[model samples]
Target chain A: AVAAPAIAQSAPTIKWRLASSFPKSLDTIFAAAEVVAQHVKAATGGKFDIQIFAAGELVPGLGVLDAVKDGTVECCHTAGYYFIGKDPTFAFDAAIPFGLNSRQQNAWLWEGGGMELLRDFFKDYNIHNIPCGNTGTQMGGWYRKELKTLADLKGLKMRIGGLGGPVLARLGVVPQQIAAGDIYPALEKGTIDAVEWVGPYDDEKLGFNKVAKYYYYPGFWEGSAQLSLYINQKKFQELPKEYQQILEDACAYAHLEMQARYDIKNVNALRRLAAAGTQLRAFSKEVMSAANKEAFAMYDEYSAKNPKWKKIYEPWKKFRDDELLWFGVAEKSFDDFVHSTRGGKR
Target chain B: AVAAPAIAQSAPTIKWRLASSFPKSLDTIFAAAEVVAQHVKAATGGKFDIQIFAAGELVPGLGVLDAVKDGTVECCHTAGYYFIGKDPTFAFDAAIPFGLNSRQQNAWLWEGGGMELLRDFFKDYNIHNIPCGNTGTQMGGWYRKELKTLADLKGLKMRIGGLGGPVLARLGVVPQQIAAGDIYPALEKGTIDAVEWVGPYDDEKLGFNKVAKYYYYPGFWEGSAQLSLYINQKKFQELPKEYQQILEDACAYAHLEMQARYDIKNVNALRRLAAAGTQLRAFSKEVMSAANKEAFAMYDEYSAKNPKWKKIYEPWKKFRDDELLWFGVAEKSFDDFVHSTRGGKR
Candidate 1:
């Protein structure tokens, strides 16, 4: 009897380049791209490989999406909200002022159909997107002087990212979208009154505490900032089934790792910042309330005019409302009590 | 000058019970206490309270030490590595095998560390102790059945837990000490042939993929697993801290949540054993050979020299190391590759 023909299994090899909007100095953010490249190479047994380039390497930082959409590069790591100038609805893909926290974002994306909604949005730009990481709730910003009331925000110029700029502008504040490298000099030169980067870990490294005496809590603009990996839609579809799954799995692993690293690192940095006399303060009640009002108003205006924003915003807002109600009754009450008590010290 | 009279800030009140050990479900091994009292009541603006438990409820499942030691709780949620039976170091803390797997000895325990670890090993058991969970890691669990060479296992079974089990049992396989909940129950069971478990996320939940087939991973000697809540040395001191941090934190959060729940859920739960029939097998030639040799050799040598182990092992060894490490890199490489490939399949 003739032996059954042996099965042949071999995968095609492919190479691509990835550009990131972030600088290498921020390890967690920059590492997401590295993780994707590493996993894909290992899974395909060297059959497929991707090279990564940090911000400004092949294109200007904010120009990443344009480059990818135009086929200048194969993929890019970025926060979709950065391109809100093109379409305000893009902010929902990353974060919005006073929006969902990290866990909520994950729930919405993976289970609440947010991914599908966002993917549909991305088709316009010709990219296939996958969430790769999240920076949990972030600290407000750093200021040269303590913000005591609403009056303090008048004409205050600060460097901020995403749609937060416009919301703050409504509150009589001027917002600037400065790159990471340029932030330190601007703050040192007093060209800006304040700035909001990430939390303590990144802030400490940036030496913001030394330049800005008042560090505020609750970065209303980005309760939880989500990061995404944008692959050329056509290029992503070309990969074998297994290679694609590996990419997704790697992204999930990196997502968890980034959060864990930030949680641990932020605690130590916060303690250090406090010891350095960084003057931690809560955002003034007036400032907080005003900002919230303006944020919702802006959202309402966007929904009335932007069909894309309206489609996702309605369901997204409802989900957030329901989740808040449930957490308010249990998580909040428990956290408030334990955190307020001396016995709850971590 | 008049001294300003000191004013006390009233403490906030709150109540909560956390169930954990192995994230969520996986009962007996991690969810024992909820089986006790799920309702928790608190007064003083919801200040004082008492309720059910879970691993990491009051203390990290691994840190039942400081939690019980510092009066953070009146009880705890935990397993023995969890204290190491506290110093051959605390082997009797859980189970010993050629040891126990679930049924063999609810007979040995409830009668063993069930008493000994709490009495001799845990002299300060002023707190109540109980048998809350157990999973007999299936004997010589999960393996890749096509071992044509003994060298295949020069270092295998890399996913054991605790210091004693992994270190002592290094024959032809490398012993890995992972947490109970994470073992899979390792990649559907066959991912790593010969894993030890509290029993089923062991053989069942993790359904060794139809790929590997050999269901020889569970190390049987783990007959019965034991968990405990070590109370504070001092505040088991005060009649009440108000059921406050003590009773509220312990009984409500840790003590009763680990094992019993795991048992209830894991029973006869192997219906999905493998959509594809699984080949149940045993450890083979040269493979089992090298393990027995290395396990005992390491034990005897360590006992002869280390006073710590000598003090604990005289009685701890029957269940101590007799395992082996095989010489192969397939498990690690395969795992890394497979995980990376998961999301790619979409």
Candidate 2:
């Protein structure tokens, strides 16, 4: 037995193609996929290589999931909710109306049994999902007119995306799922009354503040809009375990990196936006309350029809309730007192 | 009318002391203060300078808020929940058990009326708060014994911190709020049966996994643990508006950078931990359910007694509920399927 020497096995080289749903112009979101590619190549010493394509370069911006599912692309960087038209459940993989904020979403995905559930769902689509990045609770949108009440939503044509679009539609919003590139034009030309983008940094770069004066807060539809890496199931399985681990690590890195970029850039952009006379407004109580009601009603209807929704919803809801109860006392009280005070300057 | 040529006023040179809750050994959290200092100096061309002190250098690690409030330090870099003993509400500012994960916290703080509410809270403490960094949903902790059921938690003495310590205590586990430096010693000496530090990256550095064989998942309490920059309000007002804006931008930059470091570092450390025979375990359902019940009862009792808690809890709870209802349908459905499928390899 000692006479036989074990041969060291080298990992097989893997080449992957990642098509991003976002345009190259949107650096933070698009760069997330690039970050993953760079990390994978470096971590594996180039044993694994991923070629990334911007939206419309390889396929339509919204066609990424399907492209990955059909093996047209090995992977994709996209918002899971974008494919809600195919199955409403897809929204959890990305962003949902009044869903978990970025942190909560990350918690749900990474820790709160969310990752397992999502992986199972993606199996049906022949894809595996990893949260790549998140736009921390987005702004409501860039509005031509300030929304003062729930009535402001009625008949309003807005450029939005994912499950939120349909939820908004319930509030009498004429939801238009426009590509990123098309949004500015739509708002500029008055084709849409409003547009909800990531936040101030992206909004400033897009020059939406110039076209729309009123920028609303609490992107309730997307408390945290997560961007995901969807890989073809077969392609994922073919890779060596180390390569698989590297991809996962890279995606996680990209996930945090994207948020950091947004946080840093948003502050400066917000100052600039404010300087440029962008009117920042919180969503009116009437509007937020109405949207909240519609959002819940929609969920009840979906859960009744969708067993998948019900299965996870039960546990998830219970966890969320418990979380809220604790936060209400400890988290809320301290924040209230400290945030209200005025003191000496640094 | 041409405004009379106004003389450009030179900005005042300012120096500040920042007391950090974390030791320098934890580079990511500790480095946030340094990053903010660097950014402020660079942005203001060194006219504004900040000196950062690690835990116990200026004051005890946990006394940062008081130091900032009493003007002992010009600023502090610490989690809000560290001071929850003063008021449970502080947990919301930092992290609450089962609260908003990192992204959701950011949403609440930055967009969802959280900042305003928190700022109101901070006013009492004489601090101006800006989020400096975030640890996206943290790990449950490192344990000496495998947690297979609720029984494992009973009588377990764990070195944990923040709001989680109390929630864990309610689960029949003895929770010890130990400082970062003391965690290793406590675990090694049998003074604590287990320790829940950050994720594997920090855990490996601290060598906790070396002693604790069982590593758990889903830190229910700290979905997203936030590190904040608490500035002396009076000192903040003294800075020029441009400098103030620069400081805010710097905090935002650090916030993103810290998370990036953690996300990249955690996986490798996790792999190393696994290789080193650290058993990974999920918190048992019974334990989780029991903790949830205790967490809620604690909150209801506190809400009834604490006015500050009641005021904010009402809104925060409502918002969280509404958010969950919407996410339950689309997000939960997709995640349940995807996560259960294939270890989310894709």
Candidate 3:
């Protein structure tokens, strides 16, 4: 009889399925999942393949975490903060209001002891997260009219999500959490005054710029909303060490590629949006100031009440603070001077 | 007879050597090469083992490019810009004076068609480049006394490298290319007034702070110095596709990890240096402004004289310009507001 173990070892073929919390139409955001899949297959010589299922095909879009947790799918590509209701600590893995940008977040997670803290926390949920994608800082929601002050935010009905919604609610705006597929129709019918999806690339695809002519800068909420490949802990541990390493590097490739894709596509989209008569706007000092203050207070409240939040927040806060200081010294100063000379918005 | 092709395919073990352009003592920088080697070996089940040689162990630190080109080593983990003396076009592969930051460089390479341009240029050297590492924005230098204006740079002796040294030469500063081992001694004996190595992490190791009390911000000339894994074209092509990919993914992993390591380590190092009476200083606006003007004019002159430089700089300039504008819009605004509240240096 042929030795079963030897045959399996020689030509090991493993198939994995990933459930995404996004539809296929949002190419830049959802294509990141496929980036991981393609890189995996290419790197492994077709020995390891990750078949991707768009939202609702295998599980509901927002149901990715549950699917992986329940072992329905081996993995998922999703924004971890989507499950903030389950555990507020999930926000750290993605983005929180007034949190780090793409570069800052990567520095924290990869260098600032973030991954280990997150790994231990995730272990409780039977998940292993590999950063797979990031939408560079998102655009603030499109507005029906240009808002000049914090007072303008009061009673403004908008479609926003996660921690941002709660923060905006404190500013007296009504934050409506709408499904992606339904946002445009709701906005067009005046059911909501505005909506925040992603940056220029994804938002342009959704045609939000068409209805809401005033496009804003800095989502401020999700400064680089990170998406991750969450693998079921049991399933991931069962793979050969080679496959595990290969899968991880593939995720790293996708993670870097996603930001690149967004940076280029968003630049072009913003240009096109401006040409198409979308007025670019900045959040006023008053609005941003109030939001920032409210956001920090909320974090403190969570730290006091939620044990998980308290445990992670202690370190997370320090990391974020230090990161801001460092970026101010180097990255920000150079960027500011360059921009001022080039006639950019100050 | 046994089937030769099948037997060859079943166990394809390949061992290679890498020449690193850094000493082993600088773990953060040098270990990036080892990261690629380790990840590749782990991903390939030790089928591809890459032995690493520190600077001067196999070839001199600055000899990595030649070693790969001449097939003395299969590859090198070195800063591409080190070969700028041979061709100014080489600067595009790494960082140039006042060039793109780490995130923007990654965007340009991965998305804005930078890799293709670099690959076309590298063809002349018979090498292929995989962006494998980065030292995020560096410190300007450690100065014996604080620099207040453009006048302060006149006849200042400093140990600097790459395009930065030449750019500084246009200013009143006299650039000194001291060996790393001798930099401390030179600084101690007042032979050199200042030294620019990497950031706090590496600078502290070299003990620049011991003699130089004033440490500066924003090594403006090198916003982000990227290091590449330069592979011999023939050797790369000869490998089975899977090994090639495993190596590529591993390099990407190192690329991501290197910056992460620097960001975190530099933070701690800076803290230590500050505590030890190292006065952190920002280059005055007048100084940064004058340097920026000089750098761009030099680029223009190079574009006129060098055909290779002209070919790449056109697109590179456009990409850099666009990147600056975009960052100004979002990333800078958020960072500026936060830093203002947190008391950042002007």
The prediction achieving the highest TM-score against the true structure is 3
Q: A1-346, model 2: which lDDT tens digit per residue?
A: 1111111134456688889988888887888899888766654445567999988999988898889999999999998877887888888877767666555566566546778888997899999888898876677778999887788789999988777787889989999877676788889999999998777777777889878999877677876788999999999998755456556756765776687566545655666777789876767657766776788789889899998877766666654443333233222322222222212110
Question: Model 1 chain B, poorest ten-residue lDDT window?
Answer: B322-331
lDDT string, candidate 1, B56-110, tens digits: 5555666656555555565555665655534444555565433333322332333
The DockQ-based CAPRI class assigned to model 3 is acceptable
Any runs in candidate 2 off by more than 4 Å, and if so which?
Answer: A1-346, B1-8, B329-346
Error of 2 at B304 (Å): 0.9
* Pairs clashing within candidate 3: none
For A28-112, candidate 3 gives per-residue lDDT tens digits of: 8788889888777766667677899999999999899988998999999998888998988898889998888888788888888
Best-to-worst DockQ order: 3, 2, 1
Give the local distance difference test score of model 2.
0.72
C-alpha lDDT values of all predictions = 0.58, 0.72, 0.85
Report the candidate with higher TM-score, 1 versus 2.
2
lDDT head-to-head 1 vs 2, winner: 2
**Ranking of candidates on lDDT, top first:** 3, 2, 1
- The better candidate by DockQ, 1 or 2, is 2
